[model samples]
Target: MYDVVIIGGGPAGQSAALFTSKGQLKTLLLDNEKGLTQRALIRNHYGADDVPGGELVAVGRKQAEKFGTEFNKANVTNVIKKDEGFTIETEEGDTYEGKQIILATGANSKLAETIGLNTKPSSEPYVKHVVDVDAAGRTNIEGIWAAGTAAGVSVHTIITSGDGAKVAVNLLSDLKGERYVDHDAL
Candidate 1:
């Protein structure tokens, strides 16, 4: 079983994976390749003046991969809660087991709803729904968390990315039984 399974390959999911894997957790990122970021032509994100959304996402994926996060291109169909962890089913006939789950599926809440996660109307413009989460990204269901647009954050790439990182830190702290921080100094 993976230490963490992230559903979504957008900024939030990728950011979370980068942290989890770098933190030494076995991580898996499952993406369906259909995020709004893929079509964005981002210019407002911090540190970059102009960049294609797809390109940004591609780079993020590479960054996470560098930390040993496994990436799978598949549409997740179901997330079944198990006694120890979760069983993720995909449309491509693949199943992944993980001790924790992070929902970063952008504005799409279909999977969240199907899995019985509590949701509320989204505050972000154009997003109708989002998974209900605590300040630390914990869902009503234990072992399940959410970040980015799916967690009712702004659709902006920078904000979602930060939210993803925040959730990752919280999850890592839970796993480590103490506060977790990651820093690389030159």
Candidate 2:
């Protein structure tokens, strides 16, 4: 079973994978290739200006892969909670087990709804609904989390990315039984 299974491949999902994998978690990121980020032309993201949304996603996936996050192109169909974790089924007829789940499917809560996660009307413009999550990104169900626009954060690439990282840190801390921090020094 993977330590964490992240759904979606947008900035939020990629950012979470970067941290979780780097922290030594067996991370798996599944993308359906249907996020809004793929079609964006971002110019306000910090540190990267005038970057195509697709390029940003590509680079982020590469970064997460560098840290050992497994990447899969699959459309998740269902998530069944098991005794210890969850069983994820893909539309391609594949299955994966993960001890924890992070839903980063931007602006789409259909999967979350199928899993019986609580949701509320989204505050973000243009978003109809979002998974209900606490400050730490935990959903009503334990071991399940949400981040990015799906978690009611702004759709801006920068904000969603940071929210993803924050959720990762929280998950790491919960697993480690202590505060988890990652800092690189030159």
Candidate 3:
């Protein structure tokens, strides 16, 4: 059981994993390597200007790995809040339990489920873009935080990456028994 199970491997997930691991929290990053930001043609992503979106993903994943963050290439299909923590279900019928669950699943494209016309296992949903978090990156869920596009961040690759870093720091503070505060400097 990890201290925190981040359910996405995007910028937000990676950021959270990096910080939590550095704080010595057992962290796991579950993603399928198709985060929305990975499809961007980034040009103004903070220190990385005019770089491909893939490169940014590579660098971020590598950094997180270096920090001892465990990466699992899996898709979390369902989550259940439990007495001690939470349980996550994967596409392969595997279950993972954690003390804390972060829903960094990212924005899934909205597809109106109508009279069944073959919407199952064919269309990959698009992310809605995370941008609802406050300056400190707290989400609407209690004890549940968010960052990056999962919290409704902008499409600017660099901007979202910065947003990830911002939320990451805030989460770190939260782990350290500090009052939940948003550190925008991330």
lDDT, model 2, position 17: 98
Local error of candidate 1 at residue 134 (angstroms): 0.3
Q: What overall lDDT, based on C-alpha atoms, would model 1 receive against the true structure?
A: 0.96
Residue 35 C-alpha lDDT in model 3: 74
- Cα deviation at 179, candidate 1, in Å, is 0.9
- Per-residue lDDT of candidate 1, residues 1-186 (tens digit): 999999999999999999999999999999999999999999999988799999999999999999999998999999999999999999999999999999999999999999999999998888999999999999999999999999999999999999999999999999999999898999
Alpha-carbon local distance difference test for all models: 0.96, 0.96, 0.64
Instruction: Name the 10 consecutive residues with the lowest summed lDDT in model 3.
Output: 111-120
lDDT for position 15 in model 2: 99
After superposition, candidate 1 runs with Cα above 4 Å error:
none
In the range 1-186, model 2's lDDT, one tens digit per residue, is 999999999999999999999999999999999899999999999999799999999999999999999999999988899999999999999999999999999999899999999999998888999999999999999999999999999999999999999999999999999999999999
- Greater-lDDT candidate between 1 and 3: 1
Q: Which stretches of candidate 2 lie over 4 Å from their true place?
A: none
lDDT of 3 by residue, 11-103 (tens): 667777777777677888888787776787776666776877777778888988887888888867766667777677888888888776555
